[model samples]
Target: MKEGWTWRLPCALASALLLAACSGGGARDNPDDSVLHQDIASGRAGAEVTFDGTLRADPQPVGTHEHLTVTTPAGDVLEVDHNTSLAPWVPAHAGDHVIVHGELYIDPGPRAGVHCTHAHTSSGCPRPGWVELGGNYYE
Candidate 1:
């Protein structure tokens, strides 16, 4: 019985290590915004994306979310829906450059945008999201 327990101990440790690695944390090493651009072009939604854009307008209150319209350097306009309930409002204005990380959601007209931009505390948000403006990070 002692010998069997010893053998199983190593297996248990190995399984825990693998599980820790698979559990998501931090952002991927996407150096450029090309992947995000591709996601937009392909009309893919529900993907975690990060990119920089120029604020096209001031943030507006839409329910619990602070809505922002930003234009990517590549000429694509993206809506950034930061959940004010989960995070603080970004003190940004039109023409301010900003960095955004969130889950993408595509829809017709002005409904398409990114959401879930907040800190992740559980499985509901697989990847943590945040907004960076004027050197301040909001999660």
Candidate 2:
């Protein structure tokens, strides 16, 4: 009986080690490498781009920050930081399509924001003063 228990303990330890090895590390440990590895490898890091996608509004705030999800035409999803004041402007509907223009801060994670100086868009892309964040626009 003692031998059986000892053998089982070794098996359990080995199983745990194997599981740990397979799991590896998490995103928190290497945020930059985890987030921008593909972009860096592809050499498309600094390209100014416009992505068209339907918006997905989060049910709850993300990390104490207002979050907006843009599902690109190619089906790629981008999580954006709408900042503070812009939160009120976010569209309530999840399916609204929008074209966001801003520098893609890819390293830490893909995030874009239109500053308070940018003009609001009643329809189409933002024009020039204080643009809203997630509001639905007809275009």
Candidate 3:
């Protein structure tokens, strides 16, 4: 009887630890601002380009980054990604103008273009992307 109780105690502690680790934050729990309406790149996934556009929608949480859709003055649409891990995320809404410098990557659809917006603190990562929103700059 004492042996069985000892095993159950360890098992219960392990289960609690596992649940806490697995229940970390995610999009559904920490969703970004709702978009008022819907919706980067000119090339393959590692090409660097600098462009400007007007924010088409509010920021949305994607994977480990914030997703934004922007429209250039030339009427071209660009999908932008700002890594949540890189810098403190500042919320923005539609019609905000921003300038971005980043590596462009091709994705399946839905304007999924650019990424790699993380500063290279170590070697062997793609070049970081920079975003100038309002008057603040983020990399």
Candidate 4:
């Protein structure tokens, strides 16, 4: 009887392990790689990243910054804040596709964003970022 129970214990353990694998092996430490909700992980403040997205709206003025909303190819919606002096000079519009390289910040509602597209006089700022559109680059 004890020998039969020993086999049952091993079978139960194997079932649990199989179930864990089927359920994604529990939660990941970071889920930025998932296309459905990648922004939450990838948008850690101060990290540099480059991605392609379609402009969802015209640049809006947010105080001294120029803000643009975009939809990533992976279906993530992100906002961009341009604080460089050239913010007003960089033209963008809805439906335009753009390639962007920048430091990402997590913002409420909008979630991910890029800012500090130019050199910062202070230390500990994110590296300069850039936006490339239609053969032109703006930083």
- Deviation in angstroms for 65 in model 3? 0.8
- Residues 67-112 of candidate 3 have per-residue lDDT tens digits of 9897766666767777777765746789888776665665666444
Q: Cα RMSD (Å) between model 1 and the true structure?
A: 4.6
Residues 55-135, model 1: lDDT tens digits: 998999999889999888787788898888889999999999888888888897634588878885436567778888877
TM-scores for every predicted model = 0.73, 0.41, 0.61, 0.63
The lDDT-based order of candidates, best leading, equals 1, 4, 3, 2
lDDT score of residue 129 within candidate 4: 59
Segments in model 1 whose C-alpha atoms lie over 4 Å from true places:
1-31, 109-111, 121-124
Distance from true position, residue 61, model 1, in Å?
Answer: 1.0
Q: What's the lDDT for residue 119 in model 4?
A: 42
Residue 129 lDDT (model 1): 83
Q: Residue 109's C-alpha lDDT in candidate 3?
A: 66
Better of 1 and 2 by lDDT: 1
1-108, model 4: which lDDT tens digit per residue? 765897899899999999998878743222232432354565466666677778998888777778878787677777877775544346989998876766677877
- The RMSD (Cα, Å) of candidate 2 is 16.4
Ranking by TM-score: 1, 4, 3, 2
Candidate 4 has a TM-score of 0.63
Once fitted onto the true fold, the runs of candidate 2 whose alpha carbons sit more than 4 angstroms away are 1-47, 57-64, 86-88, 108-139
Single out the weakest 10-residue window by summed lDDT for candidate 3: 27-36
lDDT for residue 53 in candidate 3, whole number 0-100: 74
